[model samples]
Target: MRRRGGARRAPAAKEGGGAPSRPPAPPQREKLAVSTPFFAVIGLGAFSAWRGMFSLDTVRVLNAYAFLIAAPAMVLRVMSREPVAALWNGLFFAAMALLGVAVLACGILLFRRLAGLPFPTAVSRSQCLVGGNFTFLGVPLMLAFMGDRAAAPIVIALIVDTALIVPLSIGLIEAGRGGGSPWRIGLRLVRGTLVNPFMLSILGGLALSLSGLVLPEPVDRFLLFLGSSAAPVGIFALGIAAFLWARSGDLQWRIVMPLVAGKLILHPLLTWFVLAVLLRLDPLWVQAGVLYAAVPIAANVFIISERFETGSRPIAVAIVISTALAALTYPFAIWAISG
Candidate 1:
């Protein structure tokens, strides 16, 4: 009788599967849903710019506000609240360093040998291969997808890009220019990195985290409020930038497409292999690394181009192309990673 009862119970459990529940939505779908609002705002901004509703000066002001004010606040809030030690993942750092070097080398070689770009121009463009729109787009996307778990990885990624990859790329750019010595280039990189608002915020947050000091309630609230404004404003600014570039004459698609392909596809593919396969890090780290890599070529690339007076149009066009294409590529990437 007992055996018969047990058999019946086992059959019942198997048939019902513990409890009735809806199959969870696909992770990729969930991410897309979260992303739609941000993209919508980007479209709105683009439309506005297309209609000539915003001037170039207005776009510049918006960019400044997002960069100097809103983004720094966001970074500080996240970095301050998290424990410093918990945020430092040695494996992630190593993966980032390896990936940066690989991307930089490959970009330079491809441009120099195949496209036959001048060496300095090639070096400047190579920075785009490693650089990403981490500040404006990446942070919002990460928060939407992974929540606070993303803070450490985001911090590490930014540090690698800003402090290491960007500096090295700029150093090479200077060296290629044939005037500045190695020591001068290194010093300038260090000084610029130190003064950057993003870096300053990171350092401030780190200090807060290390000291175990809670911010005063009012101050904390202020940071939170300002930080929350960053995503929409920054993304909108991106659209304005796209519109501005579109009106600036020839796009030079021949160069633009390759740079777009490198940013949206190659970087993420290599990052996944390194983090997910080679290092076998945690899934969150792997996802963060790849997705961040998959973000568009940064607006900063255009800034660098303008500063150096080289490749401005092509780089700007690549930025727009990569960003637009990311809407399709990013969902696919999420699906791949989840799978």
Candidate 2:
């Protein structure tokens, strides 16, 4: 059977066969080698952050491409192969959606109890605490640890969380603010969410997943090749964003500290708790939550603030500090919850 997101088939264990017909072991070993470069990518980000030279926004775009570009492309290929019955294997996606919403809620609750901060402070902190650097940090990290094919679930998670979870949250949060027209705002939101690249990709991927559809050989290779670029290039963009942040030096400690704690510690725990307790997600999913949990705050928080005159100081600081501390926290989180 053909698989999604990769050209490399796994090596099945041979029965009492005289000689095995396998795609050379070297390729398989090389496939796992993807892990090595991922570490290098992380190191590059960390180093770039320290040196304060590269462009962090560039990293952001790299991340944007995975969800914005590669994800949809891969989804098209994956969609081509799914079976009818399996197309509705949406339990995982639905579960993930709940997890995203829950994390946002947890961030708000934690912010209130721990900090007693004001509205914008709370909003900024909650946004960072809830919505992670899912695209930039999570993608590379997952690709490194899991490799290309296995990264599909996390990619799906990324797309879903971005297109559906975040937009909905923002829409609700802004609903009471007395905009031009509530109906108009609602309509805009619907259109925005519907046409969202990430959401569309998820739908496509889910269709393919359920249908058990297979892609043409050339298409599969192309998807794999593009999907594979996600980690390294994305990390580079993150580094560039960091450099820009460093140059700005607009660090705000008030919003920063709590954001760091909630994102690095509380968010992951909330994810694990929600998955294992509330949703009772499978172990693999629980692991996915754990891994994705360690992602930094979105760089967009800063961009949105800077570009639209909104404030995301808390978001920016969290992005910087959370990532810095996650080096220690992530592995511990995996060890603590995963085993």
Candidate 3:
């Protein structure tokens, strides 16, 4: 074909030295965003427990599905396609390391200078607040509000979970005084992360979206139907995790309440101020920040506790407690920025 003002554009280069002038587009992520006070309903349940309005059992189921089933499915679908280089690059690893370090470093500094609490208390509080329930609450909550635009923020959340959350939690698990293999622990961490159902499902959905492959009408309809269930399932799972977590005796109001305070209030505010005001991040990014902040402390906090036997019980209470309290704070945060 004759070129119009393009006098034979340079021949497409070969593989080793020069490739195509443009890099292939990154995969497009697709997500669901549904925003209604869905979480408010959850808050009500948690609140009921607090007020003796309803039993806490309702909350445990909500948390359970989100963590156990949905999250693993979503992650597998997503992580399966991760470019090998993307998985292995030192720079990416470093960023995650720094974020993880920042979590602990900030935790120590804050606890020492400001919290004036025990070392473990400071550490647990910061860790729970900074990291989030990305796969569980984050996916649905964003979809409820932002819909398909939910995809990008979900991506950011995943990166945060993989790079920041996983490493930090492992380090905390292995704290000092031994010859246990760090790599062994790291591998175990990676293994657990990779198996998250919601993560896998999101990845599957995103893959289809990026491949220019539309689900057949019936399939699409089914997915939509299933997708609609995302929030309720998540909330129920939250309820369950909460219920189970709540049963532990002598609930540490001193530690648990502070973690809730940090997760529900401070976390979102800091994210909004930084991402929205300071960085002028994309509006979607701001939304992601809000999602990150608004999410209750992760079930993983309890998981880490269970695994390493680090303060798991309190963290569990914190997750359940934070989520319920978040009902009040989440809406306000959204309202503040809705302008």
Q: Which number leads on lDDT?
A: 1
Clashing pairs in 1: none
Better of 1 and 3 by TM-score: 1
Per-residue lDDT tens digits of candidate 1, residues 108-135?
9989999898777897788788799888
lDDT computed for candidate 3? 0.56
Model 3 TM: 0.68
Ranking by TM-score: 1, 2, 3
Q: Would you estimate the TM-scores of all the predictions?
A: 0.89, 0.73, 0.68
Candidate 2, residues 118-148, lDDT tens digits: the string is 4434544567766776655666555455443
lDDT of 2: 0.59
The positional error of residue 116 in candidate 2, measured at the CA in angstroms, is 7.1
Candidate models: Cα lDDT each: 0.80, 0.59, 0.56
Off by over 4 Å in 3: 1-37, 40-65, 71-101, 109-123, 175-179, 202-206, 240-248
Residue 138 shift from truth in candidate 3, angstroms = 2.6
Where is model 1 more than 4 Å wrong at Cα?
1-28
Query: lDDT by residue for model 3 over 220-294, one digit each (tens)?
Result: 455455455555666655664565557654588986786788777767776676666665554545655676667
